[model samples]
Target: MTDTKQEADFLIHPENTFLYIWQLFMVALVLFSAISLPLYAVFAKDIPVLLIIIVFLFFCDIFINLRVAVKTKNGFCWETAEILKSYRKGFFIPDMIAALPWWLPVALLFKNEEPGIITRFLFLLPLIKILKIGHYLQVFEKSLTINPTIIRLIKFIVLVGIIAHWLASGWVLIGPVKEGLPADDFSKYIRALYWCITTIATVGYGDISPDLSQNHQIIYTMFSMILGVGIYGYVIGNVASLLANIDVAKANFMRRMEEINSFIKNKKIPLEIAQKILDYYNYLWETQQGGNDSQVMNELPQSLSIEVSMYLNKTIIQKVPFFTKMNEVFIREIIMQLEPLIFLPQDYIVRRGEFGDCMFFLSAGSVDVKGSNGELYATLGEGAFFGEMSLIRGEKRNAYIMAREYCDVYRLTKESFDELRRKYPDFDQQVIETVAERDAMNKKKTEKPAAPVKKQ
Candidate 1:
C-alpha cells in the first residue's frame, strides 16, 4: 500500500502533468481545425456558416496557442493547465487527441534515451505518460535553467534554419534549375530543405539555377542577400545576449560562493573539508553547464563532506567556567577543536535529565535556561558558558537550555577536555577555582534578602 501510494505520487507531479496535457490538446486542436476548415470550405453548401466556423476556430486556436506559449515562457505550465481545466469538460478531448500520435510519446517510455521496439509497443499508460511529460517538461524547463551557452546554441540553430530556408527558396526561384521543376514538386521540397541548410551555413554554391525572367531573378537574388544578412545579424545578437547572461550568472555564483566560503573560514571549517565542498561545487557547475536544476542537483553530492566530518567525532564535553581566564595559547588550542553549532528558535539545545557530555560557550546568540523549579532562570549571551557543572560532577544536565532565537555556540567535548587536563593538570585547578567563585557568588545572592523592604 505504501509502495502504491509512492508510485501514485511519483506518477502525478502536478506541475508538469497538466501542462503536458494542455500543450498536447492545443496542438491537436490546431491540426483538427486546419483539416476541418478546409473540408468545410470545399464541401459545405452554407458558405457563410463555414466561413464563420473557420474564422471562430482560427481565432480560438490562435488564442490557445498564444496562451500556451506565454504560460510556457513564464514557467507556469501547471497553473495554465488548471486554468484551462476550469473552463469546460470538453476541453480535455483535444489533449487526448493530440496524444494519440504514438511515436514521440512511445519513445519516452523507457528509461534509456534509445527506445526498444517492445517497450515502444507496450502502452503502460501511467508510466509512459510520466516519462513523456517529464522529458518534454525538462526540455521546456531548460529554457530557464541553462546559463548562456545553450541559449546561444538554440538561437543560432533557429536563426540558421529560418534564413537558410528563405535563401534556398529564393535561389531556386532565380536560378536555371527552376525551369525543369513544377511549382509544388518533390524537387521544390528538396530545394527548400537544401536552402534551409546552406543559407544558415552561409554557403552559397552556384550549382542550381532558375529560368525565370530577368526581373524575377533580380528580385530573388535581392531576397537571398537580405536573408543572408539578416541571419548574420541574428547570430551576432544572440551571441551578445549569451555573453551577457553568462557574465550575470557567473557573477551571482561567485558572490554566493564567496559568502559561503567566508562563513566556513570564520567558523574554521577544516581547510580539507572546505576544499572538498569547493571541488564538488565546481564539479556540479561543470556537469550542469548546459543543463537544468535537476541535472545540477543530481550531480551534487548527497551531503557535504564537512557535515559528515562533524558527525564522526561527536563526543560531548562541558566548558569549565575558569577556562575563560586562561592564556591566549591555551584558549586558542581549545577553540581550535571546537565547532560552532547553530540552533533554531525554540529548539532545545540541551535538555534537562539528559546525560551531559559536552559544554557550550555562547558565541553570539541567546538561550533560555529553564530550572527544575519551573522558574525562568537567566538568559545567557556571548562569553557565557553552560553544562560545565554537570560534566564536572559527572551527573545529568539539571536544566534545559532552549534557543530563544537563532543561536550560535562553540562546543567542546569530554574527550577533548580530558586530553587537555592530562596535558596540563594546573589548568584543571584554574577551572575548579572558577567554579568555586561562581558558586560563592550564587550563595551570596541567595542569602542576601530584599534591602528595599524597609522603603515599602
Candidate 2:
C-alpha cells in the first residue's frame, strides 16, 4: 500500500489500482503514438492497429483524468468536480483533438478508399497529443523515483529517433537520392532512412548522392545540410550538457579535489599528511556529497529547512530518552541548531579531561569511547550519542571519543542547550540537580582521603 504522504506528494491515489495501471499504460502508449502516428501518416495509407489503440486509450484517459486526484497547496484534492475543472482548464482540448475518432469511422466505412486531404487532416489531429504527452510525462517523472537525468536521457534518445524518422519520411516524399525512388514502400523507407542517416550525420558516402540538377532535390539537399549542421551541433552540445549535469555533486567534488591536489603539490606537502587530507575529502564526498548540510539548509526557507532537519535528526532524536518527551516545536528548534560534524578515522571528537561544551549524536559510522591510553571502552554506531553527562554535570570528559572510521555526527553546542533548557523547567532543574550532585561527590572525595588512610 502506498503511504498517503507520498500519494499526496504525487497528487494521486495509489489505492485505485485501476487508475494506477491506466496512468502507466497511458504514459507509455502516448509516447508510442507520438513517434508512430506522424511516421505512419508519411508511409502507410491504410490505418494501423496502433492508431486504433491510441484513439481508444486517449478517450479512456479523458475519463480517467476527470476522476484522478488533484494536488493543491493543502493536499491531494479528490473531489471529482475539481479534477474535472483541472482537466478542462489544462490539456483538455489537445487531448480531445488527439483522441477524436478523426478518420477511423470513415476508414471503417470504406476499407479500400484512398485517404483524401480530409482524412489526412483528421489523421494529423492526434499529433496535438504530443503537446499533452510532455505534460503527462512531467507527472510521470514525478511519480517515478528514478533519477531525472535518466529520464532526460531517455527523452533525448526518443527525440533523436523521432527527428531522424521525420527526416527520413521527408526524404521519401522528395525521393531526393540519385538512384531515384524505390517502387516498394518498405524499400523507399529504408533507402530514405539510409540517406538521412548519412546526410544528417554529414557522412554522405558517394553511393547516396543527391541529384543537384533537380531544383527540389537541390533545395532539399541544401535544407538538409543546414538542418544537419544544427542537429549535429545540437547533438554534441546536448550530450556534453547532459554528461556535465548527470552527477553534478560528484563532478564538483572531483574538481575541488583536483584544486586541492594542485595546491598540495605546489606547496610540497608531506605525502602522509596529503594522503590523509585526500582520504578525508574522499570520505566526505562519499558520505555527504562534499556539501555542508547547514549551509545547504540555510538556503532553504525556514519552514522547509526545519522540516528537512527534523527528517534528518528524527531517528537520533527519538533515541534520546529526554528528547522523545520534548514538544514537537522544541524538538524542531533543537534540530535546527545542530551542526553536522564529520571526524576522520582516529580523530579525537572528545579528549579525555577536556571540558565538554557540546553534545554529539552519531548519525553514521562508529566511534570508540576509550580511556586515556587508547584502551577502548565501547563502540557506538549510528544513532548512538555521547556528552549528555557532560551537559548535565558541567564537567570534563572522562573518556576519549575517537572516530573508529569516518564518522558523521551532529553537534549541539552548550549555549544552545542552555538557552533551550531554561525554557523548560524540568530540563533546567534536572541539569542543575545533576551538577550539584556531582559537585557534592567531588567535594566528599577530596576531603575523605585522610579518613580512608586512617581506616587503612
**lDDT score, residue 343, model 2?**
88
How does each model score on lDDT? 0.55, 0.79
RMSD (Å) of each candidate, 1 decimal: 20.2, 5.6
lDDT of 2 by residue, 1-456 (tens): 246754554445634667767767777786777667666777667877777778888887777676577778987776667777888999899889888887977777777887654665566677677786676577677678776776888888887777778777767766654345557778878888888888878998857666767787778777877888887898788888887778877788989999999989999999999999999888778767877776788999999988988888888987875676667877888898898877889899998898889999999999888998888889999999999878755799999988889888999899999898888877676556766777798898888455445554
Which candidate gets the maximum lDDT versus the true structure? 2
Runs of candidate 2 with Cα error greater than 4 angstroms are 1-23, 38-45, 68-89, 105-121, 143-151, 170-185, 206-223, 321-325, 430-456
Count clashing residue pairs per candidate.
Answer: 22, 0
lDDT of 1 by residue, 1-456 (tens): 253652543323334556566555544444344334323322233333433443344345424433442233554443445545542343334334333433344444543454343332222111112223333435555556664566556656654654454355335434444455676544665775565455444675645433446777656655665767776776687767766566575666677688878988899999877876676555445644323543443465644433333343222222344664566446546655676676656779898999878888776679889988757888987657888777666689989898886666778788888788777777888767877988899899889676665664
